[model samples]
Target chain A: MLKMTFARKVIAAAACAAALIAPAQAEEKTYRLKLAETWPTNFGTFSEPAREMAKLAEEMSNGRLQITIDTANKHKSPLGVFDMVRAGQYDLGHSASYYWKGKVPNTLYFTTMPFGMTAVEQYGWFYYGGGMELMQKVYEPLGLISVPGGNTGVQMGGWFRKEINSVEDLQGLKMRIPGFAGEVLAKLGASPTNIPPGELYTSLERGTIDALEWIGPAMDLRMGFHKIAPYYYTGWHEPATELQFLINKRTMDKLPEDLQKILLTAMKVSAYDMTINSHHVSAENWVTMTDEYPNIQVKSFPPEVMGAIKQANDELLEEAAAADPLAKEILTSQADYLKQIRVWTDIADRAYLNSMAE
Target chain B: MLKMTFARKVIAAAACAAALIAPAQAEEKTYRLKLAETWPTNFGTFSEPAREMAKLAEEMSNGRLQITIDTANKHKSPLGVFDMVRAGQYDLGHSASYYWKGKVPNTLYFTTMPFGMTAVEQYGWFYYGGGMELMQKVYEPLGLISVPGGNTGVQMGGWFRKEINSVEDLQGLKMRIPGFAGEVLAKLGASPTNIPPGELYTSLERGTIDALEWIGPAMDLRMGFHKIAPYYYTGWHEPATELQFLINKRTMDKLPEDLQKILLTAMKVSAYDMTINSHHVSAENWVTMTDEYPNIQVKSFPPEVMGAIKQANDELLEEAAAADPLAKEILTSQADYLKQIRVWTDIADRAYLNSMAE
Candidate 1:
């Protein structure tokens, strides 16, 4: 029995030795991905989390895969993130899918679809309810692999230069909005401009733009948006704004199976991190901004404006479904998911929120 | 005069040429850090973001700073995160600060204070209201530096084996809760056990633990906890649970000044990612668990239970503050910040939530 045990121990040591030495024989492939983002390095929204994902991927793969992300303008132009990734100039890109409405009409479904669903509902549809599969279908045609990167739970309407009294106030007003919302704003007789993060400060400061909307207070304060625009409007039109990571298909396909898995897993981690950080930073930013920038008047949108936005959202969603097959599928799926969720949400989630408020 | 003008042009050309050539000589020094985290690699909450930060740090620094994160149980136990980082066993540790209440009473402030602040309020106190300074003061003496890593915004009570009708029901109940709340539970006659994430499943499944309170629906659903308990409760006790990253001061000091800045920037991003992910995931998890787990029943605690929790929280805070001067300072600072925020939250946040609920 002692001799048998000694042989087993010897075999165990041999197995451990093989495990330790196996990795050295394997070839390490380092994939440096330039992720062009519309956020500064210090922006604690999705950009921060994207960075974290890259770090995790490298570690998890035992340094077999390396991804380096250019946070802002370090590589490609910030506003050009989508185009850059689509064209394979960048290995990865982080931005709102809605920002590229002209390129892919169905992209808006991944980011936001007017009053489509809440943050929770969106995640369900995307992950479990075939939302991710459809999203990949759309992105595959664009030469990219997309992942849900981050989300700002529910956003404020946006920062405004003046108080909006009615629907008429939105007419001809220059607003900084991206994605399908811009189309809706344009439909409402407003002019929309796609501005990158850094340029926002200069654009608002020089009166080049009348009104703008970023994530929310936490990020807005950092860029000193409140200093230039005293009237900050709530972002009711966008309750939950999602950010996405677009990886170059060619670059991603080159990675080994394990490395590819690491990147996907890392991206998932970043998605959650972005949400939590945005909430935390926004909360802190609101407090600090109020204390420091006392002149900044934060106000909710007037009932008329909110009513108009809601009405426009419904119309826009219907119009997109009617126009494109992919948009129709994604929107229909998202809507169906939302319909089911609303039943429970209305009864449980909403009820609880109401109960707690009192 | 013509010759002089030519000379000026030549000088300008030379200067422009110098500026163009400077890029070649601007190679940054790359510093690699090995970080240890208590979260599993599959746990997108911390591991994913931590990895992303490292990747972003390298990119933002143009390869000047690189970080590699070791996930939970990869190198050390999750419970050992604080001490491992403190003792310089690892460069950084990403986990909840509340896990180390026995060693540092004030560490809970970095995590969350029961009934004290929402996620936003906590961020406000930490970043702007000298809360970070206080944290540094508390951690520096222990050879560590801390930052807000992530937050679970207003969590669900937990999965209960049976409904909790009154305070009497909680007595002698074996519950799994972390941080100071666990201590409060102990004080209230319940048995509180600090179990790591990996072990939470079997303990709750085998009847070793009567209840377990994790972040919320998002995470709980993923862990499949609802399947066993079937009685989900709202976590009014932990409104906002904060996760923290503890960096070894020695390791941090070794980095170049710019690398240190990059590290801080990445941390802020990681925190944002974690918070947002929690919210988004929680939203979806709620829908899945309710739809799939038919036997699972989601309910809220009675007002009397909530009142008891609030009362217990107040007493715990008072006693803690009385015991530690630093804890008193942080609590006081948080109170001041919350007082200022309450005015707006009560009207804006609560009012909006109330109006939105059906």
Candidate 2:
């Protein structure tokens, strides 16, 4: 009986040892991921989403996968998020795809087309309508894997210093705008200048430019544009603008499979959170601007201006198709998809809106 | 062995019956839900969100939950969603809480407030900041249960006919607007008209309204507002407008747990999805508006017009607060929250936008 008891004890100890050894061998290797987003350290939507992504990653990884986020312009230039990730200078980046339109013209499909799909449709195109695949195609060329960072839903047209009466008014106006629309603005006789956020106020205030269009009231109001520009505009042009977080393909490929999944999941969560944050932030700013800073004026643009811009946009689109083959492909395919969805949304979406309007 | 097999067969048959019976029982309990909405059927965002809610309820319940969406005007009247829900005439409502400022003044905290929180922040407030609970408190008196149905993110101010050079331009202009901003417009000397989306085109065309403001390019394009109005303005005043789905408290309490969950989940999903869809739809429409519409004009409100509106908003806020205690509470709380988050978003959101502009 004594011998049996001793043997049992030894066997039990060995079993425990085996349990520990097995998990160690089978357990995925651990890693530390440091993400550097272009957002300023203080920007809530931009900074918080990255932080949320990191938090989710940590939770999903159970501390095995640790991701530290540098939200401010810490590691690289704010606009260099894509380039840094592409050049393998950073492990990840979160910024708008339209920002890198020069690098990947087709990428605008993933970010936004001038007045393209809403946030929902963009995600649909990305997830179901070959949008993600097409987006990958664009990102692959730049050695990056693009993930949806966040969506601003339907954006206002933008803020303006002066009222745009007609397309003729846009002509010769020094405006700060970007993306394909910026090019179109240029063609319409407006001098489109691409200025960074930090410079917008000073530039507008200093009279370096006559007009500037930024996100919507949420962002613009917080940035204190109301104090300088005095005119806040709509966001009809961009509509649903998507911000992207580009992860270096090689770096992402090297990550453990579970870690990769965590990265993607966390990003999506952050994206949703950021979008919600943006909505509230803009609202608060608008109220403050109007109520406290009555010196600022908030108003809309005229139909004549919209029409002229629309006409110029057609010329720009044709020119884009003519200039770039990828643009043509995206334009054609997107147009087809839009036509199909439009019919349904028009019937379903339009009818509902009309009912509510009454 | 024979006896065991027979018993097993009986058990299997019973299980199948139980499964079948469950659905049958659910099907027998029919529910007719009346939805009160702020918009008429013509607006996509307003109509689509509600349509989705109804569709989702029907599909999820396998057609047991029958929802009838009453256009804002049909059931009660415009700006009657909360009241109708409270009165038990409507089972559900889709509109902004801000529109019901007269009833539960704090209800505006749930919807988009000027310079308050973005859609994301509003979601956070509702979900995390006890905003939903607070919102429920405000609505409980009216017998309503409100959930976020949709958001337009940021919106355009309005379309203008002439150039606004200063605050003076706001005087004597008949503008179709909505929400609290309308009150501000009244103070600014502009005649504020709350024309639903369906009526905007006609009002502008007939000269009954000199200016009209509706969402951004996507919806505006579809309405052919560009044809009649000629000026497409930005959403400066109403940056991120949130839509709500108000369900009668009595009706909601009567729903089975499963059905209630489905109704809530579906509406939430639809809200996010609708926001995204609207953005995408707008983007596509913008392309058409600019390219196809020849006489259309896309312009911004002049500085002078903006200045006047901003001034009017300040006066309106003060008067509103003095006139109503609810407005004071809401405004104060919103201002506080805005101050807290602005510190972060200003850096992250603003810096990036400024960079993008460059």
The top-ranked prediction according to TM-score is 1
Tens digits of per-residue lDDT for model 2, A219-322: 66667777766665554467568788778888888875435655765676578667666666655556666777777654445656665666777677777788
Native-contact recovery for every candidate? Answer: 0.01, 0.08
The list of candidate 1 runs beyond 4 A from truth reads: A1-113, A116-235, A240-312, A329-356, B1-32, B40-44, B55-77, B186-209, B217-224, B283-288, B342-357
Q: Is the docking of candidate 2 incorrect, acceptable, medium or high quality?
A: incorrect
lDDT of 2 at B9: 37
- Against the true structure, what is each candidate's TM-score? 0.60, 0.53
DockQ of each: 0.04, 0.05
Clashes (backbone N, CA, C under 3 Å), per candidate, total 34, 117
* Candidate-wise lDDT, in order: 0.69, 0.65
State the TM-score of candidate 2 restricted to chain B. Answer: 0.80
Residue B325, candidate 1: alpha-carbon lDDT: 84
Candidate 2, B110-167: lDDT as tens digits: 6665434555455656655556766777777766788888777556556777655566
lDDT at residue A112 of model 1 (Cα atoms):
65
